[model samples]
Target: MFQIFTSFFIIYGSKGGCPMTITKKLVPVIIACCLLFSLFLPSVQAQAAAKFSDVDPQRYGWAMDAISFMTDRGILNGYPDNTFKPGNSLTKAEFTAMLYRLFDKYRPNMQEEDADLRLAGYADVPETHWAHKEITAIYDYYFGGIAFAFKEGVEEPFFQPEKKLTRLELAQIMYMAIPFADDAPGASCQVIMGMTDIPYELFSSYEEADEYRFDGRYSEDTGISVDYYVSEGAPVLYPLVLVKESDGSCSSSFDDYSSIIESAVASMHTSGIMTADDSGYFRPHAPVSRAEAVTILNRTYNYLKANRNLQQYSSLETSSAAAGTPVTNPQPEPPAGKPSSTVNPAGNVKTFTRDLAVEGELETMIDTEGYRSITVSIEAKEKVDVIVQLGGKKSFIRHEELPQTIALNGIKQVSLETQKRVFDLLNRDADYTAVLTVELK
Candidate 1:
């Protein structure tokens, strides 16, 4: 009918850039084509939308945009039954597949065979595994340069693909996937510590916990507390927090992996790629769910798209060494005519004295170039623990009394030393200060 042909032309002719004029001779052909298209339009739209039946808008309103963006682009797929098990724990293999698919969507030139070849070096990811190609591609593309050894002292390298991914692990992977800026600033340990929201119920002693709680008031077990050092409206730093020891020394809940995990979580949070739950908890050790993974990936993609100049991990030049391993480079001498404390011309030794006010912690980075030995003298009002990390080596200066001295030899740089937990119980605003004297010889 003429009406039907007119409706089809109005809907598709203008948009498709076809001639708008209708001719009597071509009407029969056009009508047949439009009839065929009408039969398939609803199915085509349904396939393109890819909406999951279980993803109710009311329950998953926060993740609706992310889910739609990923699924519509074919970056994520639901089960055969059309349900997305959003709450189920995501395995490492699943996460890897998702990441690889996302990368492929953006960088289509990457070949699957080349990615598969990269995984030949791994021990666990067999050729027949369902996600072997994806796992190989992600690992080789992002972490190829970093050395891997089994933490249990085994020589074989293993990729436990079936293991459930944890929040901390996800943060670390996301952090590594993006290349760091050349002038990226170092993350502060204190800031990372403050971002961790610890549940108040976990504290062993209520009397001891009263000092850190807000207004000295105890709430329900479900209540959480962000440490006093964290500013209001600041992002949560890490999912894990430092545990207070009975001996008054604070130790990381992550133990040996504490520093790296804290740094990764802090970087992700600061970059707006990952965040905490409604209760202000990162839940670092908890298993990452499918919905959370996609949401985070969506955020990462958006961030990368916004910052067009930033380079991805796949574009970086990698070496055999670990990602953060410090490389010693030649340094230029300090400019002449600069003031130095007690400079000796014969030995070229200079002593620098600084008085630092320690609230939560104080971090200092000292260049140890053109020097043989360095000595640090500390004088504090109260007992404090000074942690010195240089060239991957950590030394401690626990001031049981006061006025202690420590010496370092053959060090290219002293990266960070933090003086922690000098609480002024009587006056909260008071500063517990320390005097640090560094002598470079």
Candidate 2:
């Protein structure tokens, strides 16, 4: 039996006069009634079920729900000592086993043999190994085509069955394995952009007039597009994980990578399939332990199960265009305008003459108004395509030589009050560097 005592006080103030205070105390019977009403309210501690001994209710509180959810579903379990070790590193074999179990747990019937027979033929993977099935399945899914390219003169193929899995490896693997929509990489029908000047006919999709438009590169025999790319003349492809944060603005912390992998990480991070560590780092180069891998896989499993009944695609309506038909290109025409400001490259810039793919982005604030023309001196290793967006207006230019100008009209003036004035140099496909200059009038 508990009691709560509260006193009410009212202050009466008069102009040019002293203030008076009136106080009233509630009856003991009324206090008792209030206490009785509070008895019906749920206790936060009572609602929580004791799941593990080591996972503290205070420190690891964020993961408590995920831990409980996984444990209840039988996807995760503690050690013989009844402690869930969240800090341990994950191994390759353990991860593979977890993945196999996850897919088996969800789509028990869809599991079948992949067409590639040699995938399971890794020398280290014995028929009796626990992860053989999963290793084989994933290997079959990305045969000689994934994140790590295939070498022409390699003596043998290896899955490194017992090796430790790195964070980047985990990201790549989880991304490739998950069954997501076509917008993501490695989907049954993948849409890839950023390649410039290639014939539009190269991109073909199964469904007509699809917004994705282009189908991923496919095999001549299978007629199915696979997720793979060539790096230094080697075919490579890999897997997925991601995290969807509360805020709509999403990004991954693994910044040191090429555009392709960066795009994958960004997609996964935004979709809530993967998350960063406590220090707010992705730890891309760090290895994941067996326990961590199992926990993450379990989380993924629970996500799938919860959303199992929901329709994957909301709209069944589709376009009626042919598969290989070229839709409108993403490039926009230059706007008409006069010069307003002058922008000249000041720092030393290098020109790349090697046969390699390199890319970057430059963001700057523009305070100029009216119509403008941009002039630059540049050379291309193969080709240079520059896309510029000034304020809300955009323009695209393909130049192989310096001392060239493109005019854009219908530009608006920048207001100091408004914070929306922005300019960007989208150097998406520039192999060699160039001396750039922009004039707005």
Candidate 3:
């Protein structure tokens, strides 16, 4: 037992000479390794059961792909109940446990003198977490003298280890330690702020948002908080990538932007939409057709909305002047182009009862260019038109009703997929803007 868990650490922990000499004093290590190896023998050849379908494909990016690969190699696994909660941030314990599964051992003698950073002892976890021993051991032996984000003596604290990680934060962590896969030439990590006009200072200096820009341009770098341009009557939030048409032609069309895929991947990485591969490449620039984009966006939106840390919309409920349920406060304005829908400040995520669609109609409007969110409630189950317009073009106007909710074993589940590749084709000229409408009655 002792040898079984200690071998990996001993090998990876040592530096000056042959750590793999199979020391005579630890002969029990050989026997224990054999016993455990035999006991869990069949698992060695086992394949992972996860796939891209196991993840939210669109928003997750290469992280999902890498996880699927490691999982299949038997170096990783799903939960006890057969679900891989991929979006959940890994606790230090959970991550260390995964490392153990990968190598199957520990290094108790490893000195943890120079920690990259130490977690301030949380009141609830004063070295009692199952991972305390392993984490301390690894820190002592392997990761000495490294500088991680936290302070050593535990003053203010890294308060939320359990908090979901953002895609960028995870990338930063991996980039700091692991080797990143290089981006293609001219496929640099570029962060665009004030999409209309990027800031001069941010171009060279640093900011939180600049990290994103640098991430796109440089493979690894620090962060900077990039703001929009103070001049040119730009919106309050500065430098975002304002993608224009080929001729600097300004069109609200979502179609002209295949370049956004890189942005999406970067966004996914920082926001925890995806996990990181020890290899740092996030292939965001690959070509993705609009159909793929829609599917990806839909899945990404679902994951983002489901996770609490990423939820940023302040108000969502909008009571139409006609028959919609009363929204407490006025709906917050929609993103550019879409007419503003009022929402409550309290920001209740309304579970649109199927009943709302039975009598009222979903309205659609657009006057600017950017992202927007709208939800239609169904008072009852019935065929209804969900009118969608992106960048001012009506893409899909169809009548469909939600499938009746069904219980599988003990949980409620829903699945949706588009039919016959609607809204996207191989042709380049098909891009168009749209406004969404969930028509009622």
Candidate 4:
């Protein structure tokens, strides 16, 4: 069993029920402390502006820390548009390539052996892929190839390079693949603890709050965690905090690792994922992103759902009906039908005329009032299937997966549930355009 970094966080228990908790105020003491911590870091605007000392684990996920550590050290970038798809699963080859970049510090000065597919290897992965070089190298070191006595003479060294990397597996692989990962500052690997080889200087204290530094450079002007906020009444907020592996939850503070989490969360707000509420409390520990970071972004674009009930909100405000909205209505699943030869077959497609609006369940919705409500439909040709997504303006509410059949005539459907509040926009450049991932068997 591996004792990796704990994932349990407790960001909210009290003012409960904000899908996302956006921070609005600043603790002066924390602000002052944040300033001093900045002094020790290398002076660079990007680095100074962004550092790991900040992370609201509740709002952001462990990836935020990974991202921050990579970014401050000058690595890993979001799209040219400046968005990080944290939840997308990466392939073994892709990750092996990333490992190469991340561990540039080691400058291993090794070259990749040409992908020798004649040896034992996964049938799906081939040398043609971009990560072929890195993937092959990793197999030689980390995951030894499958050994079968019957084919020993004929079997090639198998590299399951095309496998999808799991989050836990990725963590474990990254644990040792950090190139020449050294202890932070005064850390010495002479000792060992739950995290890995102990860095005596870094781990002298077990509490994150005590061990992490906070300088006054930090400001209240950072991103929020929860993606939405109520227009009136109480401000919907989610707290971001971390805990050891044993703890069950939180909506408020944590015993350790708050500073790093606070910094990471703040940075993630800039990167996206955790948006803000109208009131503002970056509920950093209110668990938001899950599985992979790419999916976190994909959810927003793909109407990718948390797949959990809306009850997860600290404030169970998912009671309002979205039937009044032009875009929402309970849509029964379309009956199975024969292929409409005129149209390409779609994994899923929904077609409706412009004036007709389909129904959907929105965990939450945001309306600017300025723009007229536009009804959009998802269509597909007979050749492929797609996943259509629609969203609300204020909340991170989604009208997920309205598959459409491919054709001149296509059917796209979405399920909406709640009409909620207004949320501050994080990325002005966020791609709001409907996305379609096509898979044809």
- Shift in Å, residue 151, candidate 2: 8.0
**C-alpha RMSD between model 3 and the true structure:** 26.5
TM-score of each: 0.45, 0.41, 0.27, 0.26
Candidate 3, residue 417: lDDT = 11
Candidate 1 structure quality by residue, lDDT tens digits, 1-441: 457777777667774675577678668888787787677664422432355777766576656666765676666778898887777898888888888777654232143233322334456667899987776556532232121222234433566678787787788776555532111122223335455453222234434443444341212331212222212242333333344434332323222123345556666665566666555576776888877887887766655444442234233212222111122212212223323212343453333333333123444455665676666666666544565555333444555523343355665555334443322222444345666556666
> Could you report the Cα RMSD, in angstroms, for every candidate shown?
16.8, 19.0, 26.5, 27.3
Best candidate (score: TM-score): 1
Model 3, range 1-441, lDDT digits (tens) per residue? 555556764776467855755577656756666786778653211222233334554454424434543454444566666765555444444444443343333332252222322232433334766655544443221121121222334433232333332333333322222212222211222322212222212222122332444323211221111110011222222123222322222211111111222333333444333423445543322222222222232233333234321123112212212111111211112324322222222342323222211111222232222213333333222233343323211222233333222122321111111111111222234322222223211
- Identify the candidate with maximal lDDT: 1
Q: CA lDDT, every prediction? A: 0.50, 0.39, 0.30, 0.29
Question: For candidate 2, lDDT tens digit of each residue in 309-335?
Answer: 112211111232111112111211212
Higher-ranked by lDDT: 2 or 4 = 2
Candidate 1 stretches greater than 4 Å from native:
1-50, 105-120, 140-154, 180-187, 196-256, 309-441
Model 3 weakest 10-residue run by lDDT: 222-231
